[model samples]
Every structure is written in C-alpha cells, then in structure tokens.
Target chain A: MSGLAPVPDAEHESVPIGSNDDVVRARQLVRALAQQCKLSLVDQTKLVTAASELARNTLVYGGGGVMRVGLVHRDGRVGVTAVFEDSGPGIPDVDQALTDGWTSGGGLGLGLSGARRLVDDFTLQTEVGGGTQVAITKWAR
Target chain B: MLKIGDVLLVSIQVELEDQVVLELQDDLAARIVDSGASGVVIDITAVEIVDSFVGRMLATTAAISRMLDAQTVVVGMRPAVAITLVELGLSLGGVRTALTLEKGLEILARRDDSRPAQL
Candidate 1:
C-alpha cells in the first residue's frame, strides 16, 4: 500500500498494490507526476486514466502489481513515465488484448488500447509465464 | 470530497483520477436523474485539479443531465481545475459553472424563470 518513496527528482517511484484503494492512490501519484510536468489537462487526464486502467487490470486479474512512476527527460523535453508490472499470469496474446471490445473478462476492453491512445508514447511488454508490464509516457507536446 | 447539495451533491470522492471517473460520473448522472430534483449542482472544489478524464466526466454529467431533463450546474471548481481545462482546451460541454452552490442555484432559478413553463 506504499509507493516508491517519491523524491523531487527520484526519476522513479515504486508502489505496491494489495487493495483496490491502493491502485487508485498509486495512479493518483502518477497523475501528480504528470501534472508536475505541466502536461495539458487532456494529457494529464489521459495519463491518469491509462495508469488507472493498467493498475486496475493488475489488481483485478493479477491479484496486485507494482506501479512505477518516473520523470523522463529526452532531448531537452521533460515527460512523465508510468510502468505497471504484474507478476500474475500473463496474457497469451498481447495483440488480442490490445484490441478494443476483445475482453474475455467482460470489461469495456478499452483498458489497453484506450490507455495507449491517451499518451504520447505507449509500450507494452509481456511474457506468457512471467508477468505483464505496461509502460506509458506523456510529454508536453 | 466534491458535493452538489448539502448531502454530498457528488460522492465520487475517488481521488479525481482518470480511471473509474466515467463510471463514477455515470453513477452520479443516474442518481441525479433518479432524485427527481429540478436541479443538481455539483461541487468539484475538493478536486483541486481536473485532468482530461475529470473534464470529460464533468461534460458527460452535463450531457446526461440534459438527457435526464434536469438542470445541472458545476460549482466551486478549483482554480487548478479551471486552469487544466483551459490548458487542455476542454469544455464542460453545456454544464454551467458557478463560484458557489447558491450562485449556481441562482443561475438555475433564473434559467427556470425564462423557461416556457413546460419543464
């Protein structure tokens, strides 16, 4: 229920999720980081929702996960990066999971792809026997 | 900590993040519709910041309020929320904004007065 101890310039924050409320709080911190980057409200909201969905997926399907929030600087530009990692059973088909309305779990199925659409950068890495990780970054653009 | 009336005009105090915001807003729209009150004023004061998701939720609530045929006004929106919305180039759609619930009510009442006396 705690996040990676956030420092003004930690570059990364890790949060452990054991409950539903924990997911929400962790994601909120990520959003705060996004806001600190001075992203537009649209971008800020997009990042928060994406992080929230990923965190929720980790909790709902994976029994909990660790959310990594960080600040990224690239080419004189600053951005917020969020990485959600879950060690639970991984997705068999990452492509299928990204498709909208393709949920076998009866959700809106907008969790992955929808999240991807909200930010400037989206990357997903998963392993069948390992776990699931979704990384997203939103810049000032 | 957002409220509409004396009894929590809005109870989706779920951190004002983007996820679950639409769901929370949907629930709020349904509750306001069901309350049968002529007007519903939402106070997002506690939500010191409004990101895109929160903005969309507010706009969605406004559209739903119109659909439910109820008067809706957003009151006590924080400066941060307003700033974010402006930066995002977002809108609350047709939702009205007020500095306080009483002011929102005053606006709603004024709108009601000019109505065709139908609703």
Candidate 2:
C-alpha cells in the first residue's frame, strides 16, 4: 500500500482488449501515459512491453478482457500502472504460470515472467473458473 | 519495402496486427526465393514497440532467409526497443543487427563481395 498512488484521484483510462488491434492500442495507450508521466525511455519501454504481454494474455488466454491504465505517484516518484482483467477460465496455478518458459499457448513462454522482470511492481489474483487480474507498475527513475 | 542491389530493405512503420506480421514473414521469404536476393535489411526505427510476437517473427524470417541462401540484417533498433527485447528474453538469435540501415547495407555488401561470384 505504500507504493499505491492515492486512490480515487489518479487519472485512469481503460482499453478493451479483444483482438490484436486492441493489444496494439493498449500498448500505445500505456506508452503515451508513461511518456506523459515523464518516464525515462527505458522505463517507458519496460512498462509498454509488460502492457503488451498482459494485453495479449487477456486476449488469447482469457478470450478477451479489459486493461486499465493510470498515472501513479508513490514515495515522491512518478509511475504508471496497468491492470489486465478477464473473466475467462482462471489459472489453476498462478505460481506455475509466472514461471519462465511456462506457457499454455504457442508463444515463446516469456510473456508472464518476462513481463514481471521488466517492471518495478507486480500483482496477480486468480481462481479456477473465477477470473484473472494482473497489475504491474514501473516507477520512473 | 524496397529492393536495392542484392538486398531487400523493409521499413516497418505501422502497428502491425498478428496476421499482417505472419503475412510479412511469408512475403519476405517468398520474395527472397523469387528474387534470389542475397540479403535483407529491415529498418524498424519508425516502429514504436517490439513485442514478443514481432520479435519471434523477425527471428523466424531471418532463419528462413538464411535457409534460402540470403543473409538478414536488422537495423535501426531504438534504444527502447532494444531494452524491451532483452527484458522479454528475445535475443533475436541468428539475426545480424546493425545500428543503422546504411551500416546494414555495408555489412551485406562486405559479405556479398567476399563471396565467389557465381557466373
């Protein structure tokens, strides 16, 4: 909670993630937000890449979902966070899914873990037959 | 896309859908076969992002081109794209990379020049 931005005040935007185009748009939206927040180039790339992976997972694994992006300020540092949510079949094992080279799809198996490594903060919540939500953040440095 | 000397130059300037990425792979491979091109220079400077999917496609295309006796050189990778790619664990293996398109062409020319001319 220390790193969480003041709730109910930060500017937030949501993008629908249903298709490839949606995923692209999600990345673009996140990139613009990170840029607006004055994140360094590398920091922006990390956040955008994480957004891309999560957005793709939302589409391919969850059968489509929604992405929420917001500018955040924590510990006197500016940052951005993106939340990916889906109501599809949830992950049976969140730990396993976060492992590198673990993939339920035909991808390179780097989406989840790699994304985790690129960002400053990460959180995931899921339940079998319930849903999945992943939130990631990167603080500008 | 532009063909110059024995090298094919492709500038990716748009946010490509997955299908389009696949199509580009096919088209580049086919063109390499048909034109007998010795090299391919891909410029991604205008690209805003390099997701894992695009990374895989690029590496796959380079592998295919090598099989077709064509070398592949990717050029103009922005710093951000490079960082993202590394963070994503995509090293773009088997693909030669250059800092700029001009350097990429020079690399291909040097390799092509060193080869014994097939009369």
Candidate 3:
C-alpha cells in the first residue's frame, strides 16, 4: 500500500453531522466524492458504507460532531479519506471501542466494528479527555 | 445524544436523499441482523429514481447482512425503479428482492423453513 498526500483539495468539505438527519448529507458527499475518484461500483459502495457508519457514530454516540472529507491517492488507485472528529465525552477504552458488538449505547453491534471492516484502511485516535478522531480510506483497487 | 435504533428506523423515511442511504446502510443492516426478524426490508417507496450510489449501498448492505447470517431484501420497488435498476445493470447479485416489504419477509420465511432440507 502507498501513502496519500495529506489531502486532495485546498479546503476539505467539512460538515456538522450532529443529528440523525445529517448522516444522509455526509453520504451524498461520499457518493459524489467517490465518483470523482473514479471508483468502481463495488469500491464506491464500500467507501460509502464506511462513511455512513462513521457518520452515524458521530451523531448517535458522540452526540453531534464534524466530518472532514477529502480526496487522496495511494497504491496506484485514487482514494477518498474522511476524518471524523468529535469533542464529546471521549472513549474510555480504545481497544474495547474497536471490538464488534461492543456498544455503550446498546447499539446494533455494528458501530465501529462494521465501519472498521468496510474500509480499505482504518485508523482511530482517541483518549479519555481528548475526544476522538477516526480516519477511513477506500481506494479504486 | 441520539439513539441508534431511532436513527435506523428514521432512515426508512430519509430514503428520499441518496446520500442518507449511503451513510446509514451499515447501521440499518446491523439493526436488522440483531433484530432476528429474518431479514431487512428497505422501503424505497419514497424514491422516484434509483441512483448508482443507492443501488450500490443496497447491494453492499445485502452482502454484509449475509455474512452476519441474515438476509437483506429490498422492498417497495416500483416498476420504474426496477426498470432503471435493470437498465443500469444494478443487480444486487446475491441479494433477494420482492414487490413489497411483506413479500420480502415471506420470501425469508420460506427460505428459513426449507433451509437444511433444500440444501
């Protein structure tokens, strides 16, 4: 796997997907962004699914948050990277947060687990006092 | 803070927006699998047309649900939607479909009852 330029556009498309309503907005951007990257139907679906999961996390668990979406390239295929950051009560345990069927909100057992599974590349940075940031990527390959 | 269940159910209404469909597919799929209700019925009654992204999400969700040992059936597919999905060659591949949510559920029940014997 190759690395991407920090970002694609000069200014990333950032939005507050705080409400359950905002998840759709986030996904529309994902479809558009994925299309622009020339992603195939299967790859596009993967990316968009990952985006939807992350956006849902922002709204349901984080209690409202922001997602920064941008384009990038790596491994000879175009890619889109969306970074979700929230200032809400941060995760107390990162390892547990990454596990499947582990939801503080009594969720559907997908949450972070499904999102992490969908993306080609997934990374998370979080702490007790320091909020959380999740970056996920999907490529044409 | 919002609830995942509320959000998942509300996604049924937000079907009007293509983007919303993409963003909530997993959450919705997760809820359906966990519910043990046989399968999921994606009510596309509100959508006038089927876009590539939406079609792709449906296919993806179905595939994911299959891995979770559940089925994903698309419901309320209008004639126009079906024609367009076909013309676009948007086959959900392994996913199943029916004219309405009720029909989809019936399909699931049949599949479940005949499982080991059919195989």
Candidate 4:
C-alpha cells in the first residue's frame, strides 16, 4: 500500500459482481488494465486470474458486490490494482479465511489464499455483519 | 462440443461463467454415460485465464468422467495460464493434461488399448 500513488476516477472502472457474468466481466476488465499497464503476459494472466477468483468470492460468499480496477503507479513502476467490496455479512475469522483449504462456501476454498499468492500486494478489511473489502495490486516487472 | 470416435471433444472458445462450468460438468458426465465414451478431451486454447474456480471445475469434471470410466485430458493451455495456475497453488491434481488435442487423443487411445480385454 505504501509508495503507491492514488489513481484518478477517470482511470478506474467498476463492475458489479452480482452474478457469474459479472465475474467474467471483472476478469476481462482487469486483463485490459493489466495489458495497458505494460505488465508481462504472465503477470497479466496472474492478475486477471486473481481478480476472477476474488470477483467470484464477492458474488458467492459476499452475496453480490462490486469490483473497482485501476492503474497504479509507484516510483516509475506501473501496476494494476483491483478492489472488491461487499455489503454482505463480513468474515468473522480472517486468519482462518486466509488459510488454505478453509472455506465457508461450497468452493474448494482456494479463492482467498490463492488470490493473495498471485498478486504483489494484498489487503483485507472486514467487520462481521457489516461489510468487507479486499484489495490486490500486481506491479509490472 | 463433438464426439469423435469413442472420445468426446469440448473446445472452450469463450470466457467461462461459474454456472456454465457447473452445467458443463453435469452435461459431460451425462454424455459420457450416454455415449459410452472412454475418453474426454477439453480444449482450452482460446482461454486466457484459469482461476481457482475453473481449475476446480476441470478437476471435478475429470473426477466425474473417471467415475463413469472415462479418461479426461485437458489440452492447449497457454504458458501464462500454466504459470498462473502454479503460482495460485492449484496443481489441478487428478486431471491429466496434454499440449495439444491430438496428443490428448493419443494418450486416451493408448490407455484404452492398455485396458484388459472386457469380460
């Protein structure tokens, strides 16, 4: 989170994650931004895949939400950042949620932990019965 | 999707939705039983991303096909997708993969030959 400059609203796009189609749109949007940021093909794929995982989590676990994606710049380095937010019941135990093979939903339980691995920076904020927000950034190298 | 000889070939040409993937799994399972196909080839040459969900779908589909006595081979994965899958910690165990559909068919054919004569 440190050293990353704030992105203007014009540079960011937000897509709703209400259904399966929204998840696919979020992935496509992230891929477009990653490519525009000049990230390597591998990096772009990783970021896009991570975004897809998070978007699905927002829809399935979070009970529908929105994903905001934008280009980030830090000290001559460029990156793509995606944030997923939801108003559904937040996670009660983040540590357990981040652990591999732990899932509250029917998924294989790899979405949260696996998305963290694919990105350079990952952060999560949640409050039980309130809401949740997860942000991830992948810098070009 | 098409049936070639004793194998079912499925080429994914568009971005996959979660529900769609689930439906595909059920459909493939039913098709395997109905067609009595011994092999299933899923081509992902046009797919650009393989997330945890899609990865799980592939594994689950393979497992379902296996239960029906069919070998499943996923082919044509892009290099970037492979790297991402590894980094994401999804090895997609239990799902066999090949570089091309042709190679996948060959593997299945070999497996079919190696199976002991049906009693």
Candidate topping DockQ: 4
Order the candidates by lDDT, highest first — what do you get?
4, 2, 1, 3
Give residue A33's lDDT in candidate 3 (0 to 100).
91
Candidate 3, pairs of clashing residues: A24-B20, A28-B19, A52-B23
Tell me the whole-model lDDT of each prediction, alpha carbons only.
0.70, 0.87, 0.67, 0.89
What CAPRI class is candidate 1? incorrect
TM-score of chain A by itself in each prediction: 0.89, 0.92, 0.88, 0.93
Q: On a 0 to 100 scale, what is the lDDT of residue B111 in model 1?
A: 72
TM-score (C-alpha) between model 1 and the true structure? 0.61
TM-score of chain B of 3: 0.74
Which segments of model 2 are wrong by more than 4 Å?
Answer: A1-10
Model 1 misplaced stretches (Cα beyond 4 Å): A1-10, B1-8, B11-119
Give the C-alpha lDDT of model 4.
Answer: 0.89
Question: Which 10 successive residues of model 2 chain A have the least lDDT summed?
Answer: A1-10
RMSD of each candidate relative to the true structure = 6.6, 2.7, 11.1, 2.4
Candidate 3 structure quality by residue, lDDT tens digits, A38-137 = 8776667666666777887777777778888988766566788898878777789888887755778845445576667666788877767666778888
The TM-score obtained by model 4 is: 0.95
TM-score of chain B of each: 0.76, 0.96, 0.74, 0.96
Q: Which residue runs does candidate 3 get wrong by more than 4 Å?
A: A1-8, B1-119
What would the per-residue lDDT of candidate 4 be over residues A53-96, giving only the tens digit for each residue? Answer: 89988998889998888987788888888989898899999999
Off by over 4 Å in 4: A1-10, B117-119
List, residue by residue over A1-141, the lDDT tens digit for candidate 1.
122322224658788876767876877798788778898776676677667777878887776878878888878988888878788888899899888657767465666776776667777777776777777788887
* Tens-place lDDT digits, model 4, residues B87-110: 888998799999999999999999
